[model samples]
Structure formats: C-alpha cells, structure tokens
Target: MKTIYLVLPCYNEELVIQDSAIKIEDFLRELVDKKIISAESRACFVNDGSNDSTWDLLEHLCETNAFLCAISLAGNRGHQNAMLAGMMMVKDRCDAVITLDADLQHDISVIPEFITQYKKGYEVVYGVRKSRKGEGAFKKVSGDAFYFLMNILGTKIIKNHADYRLMSSKAINALEKYGERNLFLRGIIPSMGFSYTTIEYDEKPRLAGESKYSLRKMIQLAATGITSFSVRPLHFIFFCGMFFFLISIVMLIYALVVFFHNGSIPGWTSTVAPIWLLGGIQLLALGVVGEYIGKIYMEAKHRPRYEIDKVIWK
Candidate 1:
C-alpha cells in the first residue's frame, strides 16, 4: 500500500478544527485498516497564524494522535502559501499529499477515490464540486463569472475546484519549482501538463465559523490569477488606447464640421461626456498596466511566500 499525507491549511478554525481533525483522523485510520493505504499515512494541519487557539488545539491533538502532525507559520500567510508550506515539508518523504481546507467543506468521502486514481497511475487527482448547492446566490454568480473569466484569460483552472486535490510526490516536486510570491495553485497545476483526472463531489456547507472569502478577496484573486498567467490584460489596455484614438479622430472631424458650418462650439453635454468617459477609460487602462508592473516588481524581489515558525509531530 502507498502512504498519503493529507495537508490541511487552517486559519482561525477554532470552531471546527477538532471535529474536522477527528473525522479526518478516523477516515485516515479506516483507510489504513482496510489495507487501502499504509499505516504511515498522516494528516497534517497547518496552523496559518490563527489568532485563536487553533495552534494550541493542534498541539494537543498531535500529542495524542499518531497520525496527526502540525505546522505553525510565523504569521497568517493566506491559504495558498500555508498549503505550499505543508506540501514542501512532506514532498520529499511521502508518496502523495492531499490538500484541502481545514473547514471540512471539502467532502472527505472522495479521498479513497483520489488514492485509487493515484494507484491507477494518475499523477494528479483534482476534486471538483458537482454543484455549489446551498450557497449564497451572489457567491454562485461571482464564482461562475470568476471561473469563466479565468478560462477565457488563458488559465486552465478546473471549474468548482479550489485547492482540494491529490498530488504525487513527482507532481509536488514540480510544483515546488514555482517560486512566485502570489501563489494560485489552480492555475499553476494545470500548466504542469501532467496526466491528471477529476472527481466530482457535492460541496458541503461550513458547519462552523464564517467564510474568509470576502468580495475584495474574490476580486483580488481573480485579478491576480489573470495577471499571473497572461499578458492579454496589458494588450487590452493597448487596444483600448487605439480604440479611443480612432473615436477621437472621428469626433474631431465632426466638431470641425459643426464649427465651420455655424461658427459655434459643441454643446456642454457633448464636451463633458467625452472628457469624463475618456478620463475614466484612461484611468482604467493605467490601473490595469500598474497591476502588471506591480506583479513584476514583486516577483523580481523573490520574497518568500510563507515562513514556517514551527513544525510539531509525535
């Protein structure tokens, strides 16, 4: 049998960590007992600098459970970086690692299927949600828009799939080569061009605590994902500039015609509308260009995404 280390990135999960850990530990043990997986399989909970007792609870759980390990970060490093830190810890040692949210929103039942696919020679097993049932209508609408936009923008990310997936040691090693400070795993994993498969499962609602995905974060993620993968956004600005230039030429011709016909200027509305419209478009173009420049600036610095403050295991 092969060993699978489940990597869970946690942040302020005090409300549900114990239950989530218990369920994960129990399921991992069942996999071991049924000879589906090796006894060395462990579930690692990464404490992403939670302000609550999340790390303390993990310490107690690690002390008592042989299958549980904990990684504590120096500060809150967001979900992707925390997950990356955990995968790096076990990539060289474990046969595979399954990363999921600590909130248990990812269905644990499909874990066996992930391992089965891994055994069948698939290097990557992606867990996709069949439907976002029971979710807020705005979340559903925005999520749909986000996925569609990402695909159109050249990032081949799986729809309805977050960071819940299985990666072989080989895949994980390839993943570590990505040294970008802004980590978008969904976009990067597909770019790996490895043999992979996806399993559809229903997403579960959070049983405890609130979600961390705010409107701002969602927009930021979408912008970052698009900017990280493609230069089309920069091209978009260029096209907008050309488009406005042509429009301005036509408008100038029309204004000259009116001026020669009546020896009078255009109406206030006509003059103000273009000023406001063109100004907005110019600012939008500048903002888009600035975002790309910012990404380049950050990448050139080669900063660490997350710092591991401690690693606890028994």
Candidate 2:
C-alpha cells in the first residue's frame, strides 16, 4: 500500500482546473480501487497566484474530493518554483509524486505508466511527448532546436520532455538536496544520477485555457536552462576571442608589411573593420560573462524558491 501524489502547478487556469481535477480524481479512484495505490493517494494543486478564480475552483474541489489538496503561493513564482513547492511539501507523505501542468495537455492516463516504471525501480520517470500534433511548426522546430543545443552543450536533457514527469521518494529526496534558487527541474533531474525511464505519449491540445508559456517565456526558459546547467556558451566566447586574437595578429603583421612596401591607404575601411569586429567580439564576451554573473548574484541572495500563502486539505 504505497501512496502517490500528483502535483499540478496552476496559473490562471480557471477554465481548465475543474475538468482537470475531475479527470485526475477519476484516475486516482481507479488506481485506488484496483489496489495499484493506497486510498491515501491524492492530487495536489499549487495555485501560482492566478488572478482569476483558479484558486477558488481548486478550493471547491478540495472541499468535495477527499483525495484533493491545494496550495496557494504568495505570488506567481513561475511554474518550476510552484512545482518545487508542492513536491517539497508532499515528498514525505507519498511514495512517489507526479508533476504535470494544469492545462491537461499532458495526458493524465500516463500516470499509471509512470507508477509502473517507478515500481520497476526507476526513481525518475519522464513523460516524453512522442508527437506535438497541436503545436505550431514554429514551436515544434524551436523546441527541437532547444533540446539539440542543450545536448550539444553537454546538458543531456531528455528530448520532448516537459515538466510532466514522476519522481519516486528517493529521487525527490535527492532533488531536495539541490538548493539552487534558479530551479530548472528538467535540467537538474538527470543530474541526480538515478535510474530513469521515459514514457512516450502524444501531446493533446489544451482542454480549456490558453497556454501560459508564451514565445518570450520559452526563450527565457531556454536561456535559463543553458546558463544554469552548461558553461559551453562561456567557453564558446573564449574560443571566439582566441580565434579573433590570432586574426588580429595576422592582420597587424600584414599591415606592417604593406606599410613598408605599398605605403598607406586613404579609405578608413581597414581601420574600421578591425575596430568594429574587435569591439563586437569584446561585447559578446562580456555578455556571456554577465549572464553567469547574474546567476551568481541570484544565488547569493539565498531567497526561498517559493512562499506558500495558503493550503487547503480534507
């Protein structure tokens, strides 16, 4: 009799919260009735300070459903932070925890498979999307490119995996030890060195509300993942500096020779070319360094990842 917790992070998902709750409740009921999990297994929703009635709906569900629980964050502390808050609270109470978006785009049916994988000794089970049928071509292509770049940078993140996944109690304990303020769960999960497996499923369209992750958010997330886990971008800057430094020396030598042989030229092209190129390279290098510095500054603050403003339980 093992308890399981499904943690859903919500932000302004009023349109989808009720339906998602119903489906998750039904699934948990089936698992409990079939003896796959204890009756204590529950679905916990973390409301990320949604402006709408999302938290209210979650409260109503918690009142009516014995297996439903809800937590409201002090503010909209991003999706990853909210998920971290919920998981941290329930890790001791449950045998395993499954994290998913409130939109229900990730199939809830995959939970049973995630549980099966956990039973098979995999501490972490990733829900990898086999196909992005509802996403636009731009999103699909950009998503692919992001994972490719991360892999090339030595991050080794799972392809087609979002924040939807399962973590056994052992895995959750390992993750809890990582106290970095910038919580990139997907990037950090593989770093735990646990036995892991992937469950593939086709992504479905949102049942009710629009996606909370916009183009800007996606770009920001990619940047955070890169800066948080890999230093290859900084290394690339070093390589670029070395390359241009060699080129500058060659040009300087060639210029000196030309001055001794053919004298000086009238046009400013030669002077300006090196000036602009060197300046551009220097700025790019500084930018990469600044990115790392920014992360360091954030970590120095030692702020809590999330603040729980409220909690509702039966």
Give the alpha carbon lDDT tens digit for every residue of 1-314 in model 2.
77999999999998989999998898899999999899989999999999999988888899998889999999899988999999998999999999998888898887888889899889999999988888899998988888888889999688889988999988899888999888788899998899999999888888976899889988878888989998889889888879978987997788788788879844556587768878987987898799899999999999888899999976
Residues 1-314 of candidate 1: C-alpha lDDT, one tens digit per residue: 89899999998999999999898889989999999999989999999899999999999889988899999999998888889999999887689999999988999999999999999999999999988777789988988888887777777988888889999999999988888898788899999998999999888989798987668877888788888898888788888889989998997899899999999865846677779888998898888889888988999998888888988976
Query: TM-scores of the models, in the given order?
Result: 0.97, 0.95
Clashing pairs in 2: none
lDDT of 2: 0.89
Regions of model 1 farther than 4 Å from truth: none
- Model 1 C-alpha lDDT versus the unseen true structure: 0.89
Error of 1 at 260 (Å): 1.5
